[model samples]
Target: MPPQTREVVVQKNVPATMRDGTTLFSNVYRPAEGGPYPVLLTRLPYGKDIPSYTTFLDPVRADGSGYIVVVQDVRGRFASGGEFEPFASEYEDGHDTVEWAARLPGADGRVGMFGLSYYGKTQWQAAVTKPPSLLSMVPGITWGNHLNGAQMRGGAYELGTIYSWAVTTIAPDILFRRYRDDPQQLGRKLPELVAAIDTLQAGGGYDVLPLTKLPDPDGLTPFVREGFERGVDDGWWEQLNIDGRYGNVSAVTLHIGGWYDIFLGETLRQYAAMKEVAERRGTAPPRLLVGPWTHGNFGSTLGELDFGIGSSGILLNYRGDLADYHLRFFDATLKGREEALADRPPVEVFVMGENRWRGYEEWPPPGAREEVWHLSGGGSLTREAPSGEPDAYDYDPKDPVPTLGGSILMPQIYRAGARDQSPNEERPDVLCYTSRPLEHDYTVLGPVWVRLFAASSAPDTDFVARLVDVHPDGRAIGIADGIIRASARESYPEPGVISPTAPSPIKPGEVYEYRIDLWATGNTFRAGHRIRLEVTSSSFPRWDRNLNTGESGARSSRTEVAHQRIFHDPDHPSSLTLTTVEG
Candidate 1:
């Protein structure tokens, strides 16, 4: 049984000063009867009082559990004071806030942090500062670098997610300030502004030729235009990148990721990096928990499928609910309780298909082997490479492939997670290569990628690959998918480069080896399930359409159709690399 806690005290609009004299506001939730309790700090641009469905950390509940919870509004939002430059100023602001939280009236010296998405990023920013009071952190569904996860991905702008975010989320913050003096007027205007943005988004305005002309001419969100203009990954990206700052984090880190989350790859990368950091310093490796969830929806149902009751974070039998799991982790890390630390595995993963939670010592669980399945003629995916002429498809930029379901972060309009891909797969632009039914249970546990030796009629184009699990009823549920702009090939330096946004045009009608990162997944393909691979040049509205005529870097609405070729002969062996887990 849990210990009886004291009455909760909720303080509103508490101030914490940064080094630059900017004051950030936080709501402090503390036990009214406790002497001093450990601190859990969550700093985010979202209002401190508002509950985030993603993180789902209730400060009131944490306070009742005998901890002082500090939920703060970061600089330039709500009660905080400063110019709102996203990703910038977080390190310093988070550092100052942590130090301040440590000395609060009912706070112990130790401080831990937990939140999802941007809130999770604040924890990393604070950890990088190496604040003396910082002890542990649980950063969920966030990224190691902004370019890879937040802004752009695989040399393409995250049009749907970022643009919608600018219009819906950030634009409202700006509106709040514009009408703060007249709350009544602001209240009426906010809904109208949202409705306007919604109309634009749902009316196929996102498919407009030039992406630069987005957020409409009325200035809903100018930031969206800034993202389109800065195609090259240059100095602006360097300022927000926290790749080299991992070593500075002294806190024991726990990373939480969703298989279908937009930042899945980035989340895994950070976990591996921090685990290596701990090994180098002779400390315990970090923990990782990956669910079969979307960005924030940690429920049993995702898209058209349900993984039963055990799938939801709210029903995890291992450690009560998600909140209880967090509390136990904090208690063990912050207070160093022996009983709380007992028998906890370093890694926990929810394997789809089989729909079961499994524990492991590390990610990519040891003994996972790379199994290569070759793409062949007659729209077949098999182990043998067939000698045949390449498959051809006409890719028109105007009528590119549509996004069915997978990992995407558009406004509420775009659905994510596993969904039937029949609608999109039926398109002529999407070339389907399906495999025979599996003879035995096959489990893929790590990164998935496809190597294609293909030629294009244009100087630049795009190659999109998707892995689907075909059910007996012909439902092609998308498991993983990725895209690569032909121009950004090999642009990254050895051992590093955040998704390489620089354009390096390819010669027309030239065959080049393109590796499409399909990201990571943990799924057991039971016997009789067929594996399907769809090759396409676009996944519309999810990614900006890649105009085949290579001049996308400049402001040109001109587009050209390209003849795409996929080779699967012995000389040019196109294959899918699946990290198959051993039974």
Candidate 2:
């Protein structure tokens, strides 16, 4: 660390005009004495001055780190002009903003972008435009596909997330837009809106059937409803997929993610795709950093368990703050300095249970072996398949499996990461298979998958698979989980459908193989610990329950109970595959 050598200057509400003649506003921070310096930009819908908007890095610290920092309000936000249509105006508007920042008075013609979540998304959108001055970007906990990871995961709607976010975060802006001119009317309506959002967050109003109709009579968040109305995944949603256009990006990227992040799956995909693109172009490979954290909190404790003192990113094994590390990274990429990352590894991850950070030259860390554990009789999880009959369970949409905790982006009422699964496991609808206590310490540090041969009485149903670690005292903590709707079983982007709008129906007694992606995990199960897997039909609130009807979406009010049979016989061996890391 060094002392400040130059006077700090601040400029407020600087306007940048887009190609469409709409003006977006920003606040610039710079060193008054410096002739020119690399510019750092953050574009977001949240107000530029909102200090608590992101947990990743601070703009004031970034400005003090000897760079010109520009924080802008994206189109249709606080100080900007234009109607806000999420993901529609970002590409062109972001491109125009980056180019504008490059020409700022203290800017050195090299531009770098940084932020997390929605701001992270803006960086990816901007990069696709291929601005020559944009040098590097650091995107934290963002998605590769809007339809898949951001909006829905494994063909399940993010019900609680969409509802909470739309009401609490986006509705206020919408209200302001509708009543900006009438102060008296706006004051009168704002309290009613606040009360409505409060009721929704407090857990009473979420049970509203037919998701398209919310706010009682009419929908307040039209965008949230629009997502539900889209029956088929097409190129329309793919237009927001940054991973598909990675070849067009020339900037070196640093992808930072959390182990318990809702976007972890997509974040890893983005890093891998960018790495391939960099290799093809003969440029520096993309770097990845993952820590034990939720969407907002990055600390030793999440939910009920405290990992350890070393788990916090700020105090990570005596390393300096994460913000300082990011400053060093920018120094290397934007200023061409070699002191920061001269000996740094390409990938850094925190292993839970062990509570230690490990660095690797590549993702998956090489030499990881895939081991399959079959679902056997007597609720046993073993390497050998059973010779008996299949296990059957009844799933009622009226009473779906309650979501406990594990990588959720819903309301704060449902905390994320590593909570006890006893409440959920107690339900008869959830079938559990537990492994005997391991004789040796086993490390699983990569992607986890569950392959199931199942049949549903209903034409359309849902399948959920969860991976858990069972402690000696009988605590089952959820590690990771995934879901697959029967309609989207055959393929992704374009699912197998009987008609253009409706998904194909499953024969009542026929068996079909389903793959459930549990995403990636970095954990070390101790010798005394037991590995557990739970099979169920739904994770309510986190994902909307399938009403067991041959309908396109949850818009249908008709519901039916589904009889689900999971086959584990020799003919159809259902198994859980773990990526084991061997030293």
Candidate 3:
């Protein structure tokens, strides 16, 4: 840890003028006795004074560690001037803020950025502009593309997260700003909004029809409606998305993510893109750290499972805390004390089941072989191909499967991470294919996917694939999962590449091949543990339910019952592909 040799001073609501002359507010923290220290800036839509926003790194501590820290509210957010349209003004605003922060009273004109989630995204936006004074950044649990996994996944709306976040997290601020001057109006409307938020928090209101027209009577959150009305081909997403733009970022970066984070896929994509840029430019390669954590929870326990204390971000592998990791990287890059990071590895990942951290020179750890497990008759997953009768099930939109676990962002009631899948497996709609107990520890270290030859009786539908590790004690724990919308199957041409413009509806009752990307996972399936694959139609509320009517989910309330079939014949060998690493 850096020495706390200096006392810290703070200034609140400091204003910085943007290129458009709009003023944004920030809180500045600086050492009482210092001669122009390096500055660390974080811009976020969340309140600057909110403790939750600063959970990863404390600004006061950063200031005391011989640095000036500036935490700013993004435009249209708390204390900042301008209308709030998510991600629209981030690039320009972020660029302006970085330059302004560089010129702060105690700043040495060299700036580094740090924050989690949306704040992490702000760093990317600014870095893409190639801000002259920006030297380094650490973007944690953030996304590179907005549509791929941030807002929509597999061409299906992230209904649970989008609704809960907008209603509970974003609306309060919008309401506060709207009625700050009028107590009578605020009193009359605040309770109604609170009631709606409370309903959402308790896992209600998600079933409302015509998703685009949720109960926003005051029209406080127009973005929610716009998100639904806009098609994937619409140019609006370009303003917010960072796809194909990593080359524009010149700052050295450290990408941090969690196994169960909602944006894990895009986080990995961003790292790979930046790493490619670094290799081409002959600059230092970016670092990566992935833990067995969820969206904002960095603790050891997630869902029903408890990874050991070594997996905790606070005391990671008993080496240091997250703040220490950030400071050491900043010291190396911003202060030119390269020795501070000499022993750090380029890639550090927490391997679950093994419950230990592993260091690697690159991701996917080299020498991983692709292993195929075929889906066979008698509900078995085998190494050899199989010939069997197709399995069929009826899917009802009204009785969609509940969201149990995996990489999902929703209300606290719906926990995220590894959880028991026994309840879901019992449902008739879910098809389970199980492997016999493994004789040796099987380690999977890279991307996972499933290939299925199936037929549906509806014009459009959805297919979800989940990977599970079945314990000897009969516990079915979810590891990773993915979903694909039938009509929008062409959106994802490959594992990580997503072109969400085109949609081709499937022919009813005609067999079609579908590739379901389960993202990636790093786990050691211990001996005597069984590997299980689950195939289903919906993981409700996590991703919007497909109505099977070939219409937009946003504007339609109609429902349908679809009969789905899974084939496993010699010619149509449905299988699961796993990237395995040998000991």
Candidate 4:
């Protein structure tokens, strides 16, 4: 038998108190050996299936990785006694849970937390409180942005993902029409979503959204009704930034986020905020590992089988490669392990197109300078703008540009290869900009931003940019992309209206500068690889439909068609600015 093997022992039904007299349930997982060890706890919205653990990060590994494990249900979840309100009592409940777990029979008094997603949120909550016994955390693929930005991007609420999770997983499928009052009140506003969640406390004891529109409640899942009514970006999202309040948490964190994850921004934010706290407290910030992946599974290939040649050199698991390294970190911090004491660089990111890992001293690197590639005729992108013969494309919001190339969720089988984009350029609505087949590898990192000058025949429109790699053989695989509504040109905060009182049809010759963020990417423009930029006006379903009327955009059930033109000359300087590595 292995000397470090832990005996299966659990103290069930243990209770910890929240400030409001609410109680949280925790089940402790500890070593059979009677020696003291540092405590590791995770408080989550998920049930602590004492029979089957909910977390993927191994606590037994923490035995070899050297720590005690405790998994607990957050307030109002499982056996815990209280009403479950998103982010409302997580901070207070986590503080109590961690402090209590640290005093378990063989606890060393120092505590750490581990988990992902909602579990990860609990860690941030525990750390933010600067709990007396809490020491460190390994939060993976989680977000503090509970609504608006986290679940929905650009006000596009994720009706399918959220509703599916609630109805299918929460409880026995049942009818709960009590929440049908949301749609009218919220109209997709933040406060309304919270009220919707509050509506769950009604007589039937079901969660509901604020003024949520449950057009088909009779057929809809319970989660759907609750999510719709609650789909706003109100202060309910403050939990996403609890790390900002961590002057009390000097724990060394080890941050992890996947390249294809929806929570990439939060992972980055947590690391940055933790680093600030550690600097002032004379400790180092948490180490970070961003892998080329979608969602949680890391340190492994995407699916069941490898794609052969394309997936040559990659770390299948960040945990195996980095855990021992991190253990050395905790050894240095918690046990004075000398080998763990060393200074490392600031950041690491998974470069997508390149399919490799790279490091940097800071994020949004200061070295980020722009290299503009102008759009030329005949689907060409060159340093030189097309003269006399400018390429033209017409955009109709009715049949807007389809979705392609970006950090999104879908099976890998359906994702098109970089050159797959070649066919999309065939459409009249998409403007193609391609550089001649690359003479050598052109790798780019950092956020890809595009600046375009355009005008529409209608008051409102959209500008979508797709970054692609067109292979010499005509394979246009998507890399990354972004979308911006024309009416909200001035700010995301204000989705403005054009000709609000009097509808003025925009003249074709009118010019407007549109800045669109293509998010981030790590790709190499291989020799013979033609770098392409496909510009269109919509990414349907992914982005809410744009009501081309401009003034009543996105809100009104009605939509109008708009004609858009792209200009690329001295008169209209349209260009794409990308961050390229020295390679």
Candidate 5:
């Protein structure tokens, strides 16, 4: 740590020219009396002046800690000059900006990046370019592949996240930029847009028919329409995807993810990829830290449960805050003080239910074994496979299952994270298979998946699986969940991998096996607590409802009621698989 805090100087609208002659602007914060210092850079589409963007690590504080901080507005945003195309310009621009920042006055030729969400993505984009000045990064709550979890997941369009993001966040900026010079048009259109945003936040616009043509009357967000209309196998998503390009990233990384974050799967995938590359090249291994957090909420309490104050990013288990961790990491990687990170563990995860932090050398803790729990008759989950009749449920797209709690991003009305599922269980459309109270503590520390054997009356449909922790008091709290579109089930050949192929719709009333990737979770169900599994057809708005007509939800709004049958007989045993670690 720095012996004392230094006085800071601020420079606003510092310009950095990209290769295409487009100039991006950044706010520079530096120590007043420092001869030289390593630079920490973050480029984001969100305005650099916004306090929320810097909540992860304030530029002024970082400057006081003897680091020059640069917060840049990416091209086509705020102070940058260019047309805004999301995820299109970051690669080359990030490369140019890093070289420019390294040459700034009173700066050593070293640059490290840090940010959460889209800014985090900017870091990955920059690293993949192999910038000479880029050495380290902390990517929090970000995705590696745009198709897998960012834009779409399990072959279903991320309607809730994409729609809410465009309408509530992106549209306003485009509207402002369009009418900034014409006050008359701005005055006429601003109120209407505000009303639309308000209505959407209050859970209104999501139900609009022909999802491709969501109520964007002013045509502010054309990308939203294009995104919806594009098929899952479209070549468009491959341009920005970082799936097979991880080996190109040479920067030492410290990945930060949340169990309930929208991009949790990709975060883990990035870390695993980097770790593998490091091992192959005999380089330093990347570190990881996961907490029981939602997308924007890093607090102790999420939807209903409180994991304890130690879970907060502000003060993690009496260790310093997230900023402190970043400072130490930069000090080690950029400033050549490797000893600064000697005390920190490579992997630190917050296990819920146990409500505590645990450290290990790696993820998926060594010695963990996969355990299978079979679905049995009379709504029971057991270890033994038994003969039983298939359970049936009627799924009507007209009254699809409401988006309950789990890993979801939407407007404020729809909360994410673990919430009580008792009310949803009462609905006939949801099939519940619960295990009896555990005799001992059951600890699950890694990936969670469900293999379903079922048939539907419709040509195509969706299957949703949710793992719940049932308290002795009858509270069913969601842990992890996943969904698989029947037509694209083959696209996901294994966990954490999505290879979109031509859609193959199943024959009506034909039983097929589907694998639902529930992602991963770290939790310990205490003795006397029961485990539950929920099977449903739809999670509306969160994911666009599968119309059961073998048609894209983006183009068609035709509704169909499908009779679903779940098999658990000796020949067709559906089961839930969990990665279990000894307590």
Candidate 6:
């Protein structure tokens, strides 16, 4: 790090008016050096100075990072005014914030947004507003799909992570009577919080953490209470998804994500959707970069195991590349510096394990192939085409097999391809389908979907599929995973139901085709790295268990195990569809 020109930092109070007359206050980071600079703003509910990395950014220091930085206390969090509702007011305030920041004296009149977690979600909503001054964004490891995917995945709710996220991350400051400027004050208050918990348990009417259970696991966030009150996938969830409007994006996007990141799937999904729309409309798409990092892998390893060891062990120059890309992208997209970045590819993926960068004309590469591995007899995952008898096993929901590991994640589950479903084989509830390790380096890009043509004994059931990379040392690391609730089989976006009562109508003799979207990943499983696919009915704790007999199970009520089975015969060609890149 050498000496460089430094910008003067100054702070200001910027006002963002909500749809109603309420005003949200923000602390702006502007260059005291004067007239107009590019603006990189993050309007977060977290207090303006929650020290991140080495030193957290205050208005002056934050805006000093070569641009005007603005951090706001969303609605009721800090110095801001108005009742705090989760993501409810952000979309509107976000639009107002962008318009407000661009007009600031030293602002370059172009806005670029970037941040982590909630900071990430802000980009999702803000981009949709399409403010004239808003230019580009680099949404790091954030959820592209809200409700079901962010907090809930495949009808399964995350208890530890989500609750912790709410308490530590999303809880409005007013709830704890805490202030944002106190970095360690929140942690210090934990003791008092414990005491508060004790007081509430001892008959205090003021219950601090108020989270209600929704019929669907996706509806658990405090911000999403508006949706839970309505009890459906109303406009709230859809507002976060840019699926249909990908074609409208005029700004350059640099998506940063990791294999162990819970939001990795959505990150890839947004990129792919954006490209899909661009292709359909015959326009250029957003740029993507898949790094070998974790949920917070901005400047670290893939997991606890350091991928970079020794001189050769150095991971990619992530921070350097990010700053470089941001500068160049701002020039290209916001400043009309077209020729400056004419050579940049639409997609640049970092292949883990191999640890190198590769450019692609399009995602998945032009001729990337697919590997079809059929499940075989006695716990073998073979690439050999199947032409024989069906292999069957009973899946008991009550004694359901445990979910080993996979890509669908929370910050807690931070390992890449680090899972083995073999242990579950001892139980009759799980089904394992695998393939031989590669003889050479190979890449699997895009979605790893599973199409199962089978029948469930229970009228309503859910199917889960996991993609794993088995090492020679017997370490089964999870790569990607996806699941679907059976009753909702026919519909794509809507919820479906299956009765658990005795002798349900859609049963035993019938066959159904269930498509489990396993999301996407960019990994290099070296030679001798075996590919394994684990299919099971339940991943407890990670997912709310499916009670057999298709009965209505209460959120707080007792659990009921299911009796499950898988049939892979000539009549039922149950198989996995992988988007493989020939390395």
Which of 2 and 4 is the better model by TM-score? 2
For model 1, the run of ten residues with the poorest summed lDDT: 491-500
- Model 5 lDDT tens row, 224-271: 989988877888888888888889988999999999888998889899
Summarize candidate 4's per-residue lDDT along 1-583 as a digit string, tens digits: 6574456566777787767787777777677776688877877765687423333455556665566778787766667787565566777788888778888788889887777777887788777777878767778777655432345544334433353344333321122112325654324343433343343322111212221443232333443444443323344344444534766676778777765565665676667677777777777656776766555545334432122232221322233344454455566666666466454455666665556557777665557666889876566788886433545456654565544434544223323222255556778788778788788888777667677777777676667788887767677777767666565454333211111121233444578777776656667778888888888877643454555665432134455666677778777777887887775
Q: Per-residue lDDT of 389-412 in model 2, one digit per residue for the tens?
A: 788999998898887878888777
Report the C-alpha lDDT of model 6 over 8-90, residue by residue, as the tens digit. 65465667666677777766766666556788777777777564411212345444555777777777666678766667667
RMSD of each: 2.2, 2.5, 1.4, 7.9, 1.4, 6.1
lDDT of 6 at 256: 66
Q: Which ranges of candidate 1 are over 4 A from the true structure?
A: 1-5, 53-55, 182-192, 200-203, 216-220, 492-501
lDDT of each: 0.82, 0.82, 0.89, 0.60, 0.89, 0.60
In model 5, how many backbone clashes occur?
A: 0
Q: Write down the TM-score of every candidate.
A: 0.95, 0.96, 0.98, 0.76, 0.98, 0.81
lDDT of 3 by residue, 1-583 (tens): 9754667788999999999999999999888995689999999888998876566888887876779999999999999999998888989999999999999887899999999888999999999998999999999999878777777887888888888888888888999899999989999899989998888778888887688868874778889988977766667887788887899998999999998999888788888998899999999999999999999989999898999998998998898999989999999999999999888888999888888899889887878888999999999999988778999898998999999978888888899999999999999999999999999999988889889889999999999999999999999999999888888778775678788666799999998888888888889999999999999999988988899988887889998999999999998999999999875
- RMSD score of candidate 5 (Å): 1.4
For candidate 3, the per-residue lDDT at 277 reads 96
Clashing residue pairs for model 5: none
lDDT, candidate 1, 1-583, per-residue tens: 9876468888999988889888889988888895589999998887876778335577877887778999898888888888787778898898888999999997888899999888888888889989999999999899867666577666777777787777666777778876789999887777777775767567355766677766442365666777777754566777777788899999988898898999898889899889989999999789998999998888889888899888888887345667877887888889887467576678989999999888889987988889899998899999885557899999998897777768877655567899899998778889999899999989999989888899999999888899999998899999998887788766432122454455789998889998888878989888999999999998877888888888873277899999999999999999998999866
Clashing pairs for model 1 are: none
- Candidate 6 overall lDDT versus native: 0.60
Ten residues in a row with the worst lDDT in model 5? 208-217
